[model samples]
Target: MVSIKKGSLYIVATPIGHLQDLSPRAQSILREVDFIAAEDTRHSRHLLNHFGITTPLQSLHEHNERFKSPVLLQRLHDGESMALISDAGTPLISDPGGFLIQAAHAMQLNIIAIPGPSALISALSVAGFSADRFVFEGFLPAKSGARQQRLKKLLEESRTLVFYEAPHRIFDCLNDLVQIFGEKREAVLVKELTKVFETVYRDTLSGLFDWLNARAERQKGEFVIVVQGAQFDNKAIDPKTERIFWLLRQELSLKKAAKLASEITGVSKNTLYQFALDSKNV
Candidate 1:
């Protein structure tokens, strides 16, 4: 029996996919709270009913969060405990609840966390990239131009990058990524995590793009993309390798040229790729 804290605003994390992934503490918190602020009441009602919890639910999504924050805060001030939950996974992670959480902070109420499943953390765990430092860019812009521009700015970032993507735009997103990030850049696509049809694919940008377009079924699921950040080694490249890079660039894209040149010279592709860019500017 978990003790429900009075006047506390619990930020509970629910299951991302698997029902059993919801922690016992999270279930207890939801059931014990005076009410739950859900991203979607209809969707959340089903989840609560599944767990045999009949906690009252009120809608609190991006559209109405700002307006409803004050009302919910007042309830908390009245010594009523509340739990904030998203449609799935952790609250405020590419989801709503920021306004309510912020209002609670202003009132100096208890803000508790009941952590559980998270798609971002789950994807990183199996991405095989350097997870020590990472950046989570929840969802890319819907437009092609904006998405490309956003990716371009992060081209030089040395930490792993994570993104959540919609199923319908997954292919288009990959196309833009390949264009800006280079086909030789390594990336991982995690789909339907914790679900029965879950898949984790690791490949170069081009390879993953090809594989995704090769089959229509692969494109139908929630996606989390983990991309390796720019990497460069300190070993100075000899003139021969530099010459090889130029030779390849004559017929290949900068990234492709760097990949081939590095293969021949045993130099770092990112280092050679950066050199290609610098040389092009000069």
Candidate 2:
């Protein structure tokens, strides 16, 4: 029999898509806990029914987490063990239930994590990119302007970048990526992961955009996009050239400034353009 410690909060990771991905230990903990705190009780009920786990569930989503956390903490203080689960994957990874966990820590309550599948990790595993160093940007801003602005900041990041994107915005996201990061930047798009129609496409940003546009059916699932990081140049920008560019930028349009600076400093136009982009981000 699985042991449940009194007054403990178990942070369990559920499967993202494939039901079989749920670990045996996670199943044991879920069945043994007094009650489960789920992001959506109705959605979670299906998962529970599959495993014949009848543990009671309480909703603890973003809207009501603040109000619900106190009550949950009191129950834990009174020695009721609970498990926190999201609709999919791990709780609090671009999901809700963070407040309850934070409250548990502040009170010095017993807390444990039951590791399992994560879409981020799964996508990275098959992304065919350098995973030695990477950044998990849970999701990008919904609006184009804000999303592009955020992408601009990440343009110079040397580490691989991972992001979760919705089906509807996948096309738009790719378009922006091609425009900002350039058409030839290597990237991978994994959709409907671990599902019957799972698809993985590895191509340049522009090529992926064109491929997705070929079939409407391809746009219909949760997407994990892995993008290769910018290749950093070994040669540093000359101090005088950068100073001249900034001084010109103050008085002229960025394009005009970069153009004139390139000519005056005998620097490549592409290098000066990139320098201007980095400066604006700063």
lDDT of 1 by residue, 1-282 (tens): 689888889999998889999898899999889999999999988889999999999999999998999999998898999999999999999998877887788899999999999999999999999898899999999999999999998887667999999999999999999999899999999999999999999999999999999999999999999999887653477878877888888889887887888788888777886666545641
Q: Write the per-residue lDDT of candidate 2 for residues 116-199, one digit (tens) a residue.
A: 988998999999998988999988999999999999988867679999999999989988998889999999999999999999
Q: For residue 153, what is the lDDT in candidate 1?
A: 87
**Candidate 2: stretches off by over 4 Å:** 235-282
> Looking at model 2, which ten-residue stretch has the lowest summed lDDT?
273-282
Model 1 residue 231 distance off true place after TM-score fit, in angstroms: 0.8
For model 2, the local distance difference test gives 0.89
* TM-score to native of every candidate shown: 0.84, 0.84
Error of 2 at 4 (Å): 0.9
Task: Write down the lDDT that model 1 would get.
Answer: 0.90
Q: Please give the lDDT score at residue 32 for candidate 1.
A: 89
